[model samples]
Target: MRATVIGAGLAGCEAAWQLAERGVSVTLCEMKPKKYSPAHSYEGFAELICSNSLKASRLESAAGLLKHEMELLGSLLVRVAKENAVEAGGALAVDRKGFSDGVTREILGHPLITVVYDEITEIPEGEVVIATGPLTSDSFAQQIKKLCSSEYLSFYDAAAPIVSFESIDRERVFFAARYGRGDDDYINCPMDKAEYEAFHEALVSAESAPLHEFDQQLKVYEGCMPVEVLAKRGQDAIRYGPLKPVGLTDPRTGRRPWAVVQLRKENRAGTLYNLVGFQTNLKFPEQKRVFSMIPGLEHADFQRYGVMHRNTFLDSPRLLEQDMSLKKDSHIYFAGQITGTEGYMESAAGGILAGINLARKLRGQAPLILPADTMTGALVGYITDETVKDFQPMGSNMGILPPLSERVRDKKKRYGMLAQRAMDSLKAYLQEQGL
Candidate 1:
């Protein structure tokens, strides 16, 4: 049977790839080229709208464990991302264009996949999976609103800005990753206590863009909190967050600075840099005026300014099954950010599971409800858990996983044991299912 996957974003692409790989025909639909969202520009699939870095690659980290699970499930995007990786210390950073282009090429060339360039206003008949991403078109969003009540969706998220590497005050910025993971890969903008207080004053006092009455009190996703909102929490909150000076000694002072603004490489060329954890909804001029107060960004030229946008997602705990399918309709499923799974890799992980479960269903086999011990299973389980009264998008974190049969005290050893147990369960499931 043929299945339809909406949107060529990360989740949709993986969902399409999995179905196609398992001998099921898929029609992959994308609204790009003909039309583009405020955040999207490239005509390629699986576009990276935010930072190019996919976070830390260590198995102990949550993102690292998710990628491990995805690779085991044969995720097309994960493989391609690693192939186009750029140096970001231990993070799986990729060249955004290459990553998107590689995915587009794969989808267009796949024998069982047919690429359809059109905006789907109405849900298609037969089997379908909606992975419209955070910026779902208003028309399709209304349809989803009708399916799942308006109260079940949310529309608040913001992204950080990117600055030209040449625009930075290099003399004021030192290169180093936190705790010196691999090598000096991050360009950290050091600040003294005096500098930080002055910057904080400017940031909190800066003018933000006006929001709609409906959006004025928006529920910003916890994972992508706006820098301004975070700043308002407390003076030291930001210092503890994005500006925390934890792991490196500045070459100039031979001591860790009071605070630091880290700029991560946005691409392999290193021409662009992401203001790590600086997501904001400040006006463009205000962003320039305030953010430039940083020691290394005095005359920074912004390629992309920090802007807030609406990100609509369903309350999946009440709507989706463990496999990410709609509880009310077995033939319909949800994946990606739309399914309330946060982060780039987390969304892709949802796509993989949804695709696998859908394939199993097509083959007359029971959908695999992964054990809670695994990261992927914990994440999926959390989103699909009906007991969660107030549903929110969740990223793959070790906290969500069930406690081990026995506790191991040391931090690294504890995480290592958890990872080992998860992999063991995943391998056993794969062998038993021949997937």
Candidate 2:
């Protein structure tokens, strides 16, 4: 059998790989160089348009467990990501360019995969996967809307700024991770009350970039909320939100700082680091002026300024089946952020299942519907649950999984047990299905 997977993003690449490996001919389509999304610039597949880090990588964490599950299912992205991994303390960070280039090589090298470069304005016939992503082109988005007969819900998401490590004042910063989790993997810029107050004042007053016509009436996603927008909520809002100094003592002061700004490694070379929780839509000059107020970043060289863009997702609960196929048409499947599975890895996992289920159906085999207790399964369940009203995008988290019979109060121990249960359930289910 043959399949057409549109949009050679993380989801489309994952989906195309799964089908090809399972003895299906795949046509993977991408629209780059010809057209670019507001956030995308790289002319490569599986581009890391946002942060380079893929959240925490410890098996006890939700993101880590979900990745382990994907590895079990022969995830192409996960394998390539680890090979291109950068030092991110307890998280999995990759050199963005290296990771995307690696993925492009793998997908293009696959014997059963054929790549096509064009904008798909209309849905294809027969077996098809729509992984067009959140910043889908207007022409194609309208086609999707007509296909589902449901209005797409959207929210604004922002990217943080990256500063050159050499430009950061070493005298003003200390290297340490939160609660000493990593081996001094982060550069912490401590702030006294006076400094923090001044920064907050400037951030709230900074001029933001004007929104596009489609982006008016802005609704921001809490996960990627611009630091400036969050600051306007109240004076101490950011202190509790992004600048919280709950852990780590400043060696210079011998006490916890009033607030702190963290810079995380953006590549393996450690030449660049992104301001943690500093996503913004401020004017370029305003960003430089306001952000420089931070102690270590007084003269920081910005490699890339912060930007905000419109992100659109379907009301998946009302329109998609558990396998990520349209309720009205089983031949068409949706993946990625467009299907309401948010975050980088979550989108890839959705694609894995959509491809597996579609390929299996063609072979007259049972669909591999994961157990609800698994992180991947729970995420799919949330998106497809018919009762979910006012649907929003969701990412991997321990809270979404089925609760354990035994209550463990300690947060770490509780998460550990939960992770263990999820893994066992996924393994057992896969074994039963002979996968």
For all candidates in order, the CA lDDT equals 0.84, 0.87
Q: What residue runs in model 1 are displaced by over 4 Å at the alpha carbon?
A: 157-309
Q: List the residue pairs that clash in candidate 2.
A: none
lDDT, candidate 2, 44-138, per-residue tens = 89999758988888989889999999999999999999999999999999999999999999999999999999888989999999999998998
Q: Which one wins on lDDT?
A: 2
For candidate 2, give the lDDT of residue 421: 90
Number of backbone clashes in candidate 1: 0
| lDDT tens digits by residue: candidate 1, 1-435 | 789999999999999999999999999999998888767889999999768988879887778888998898999999999899999998999999999999999999999999889888999998998999878988998888887775457567777887767668888899998888998889999999999999998989989897654456667768789898889999988999999999878989999999999988754445457788998989999999999999989988675677676767888878888878887888998899998788899998889888878887888989888777788988888787776554545666665666666766565787788888888988898888776
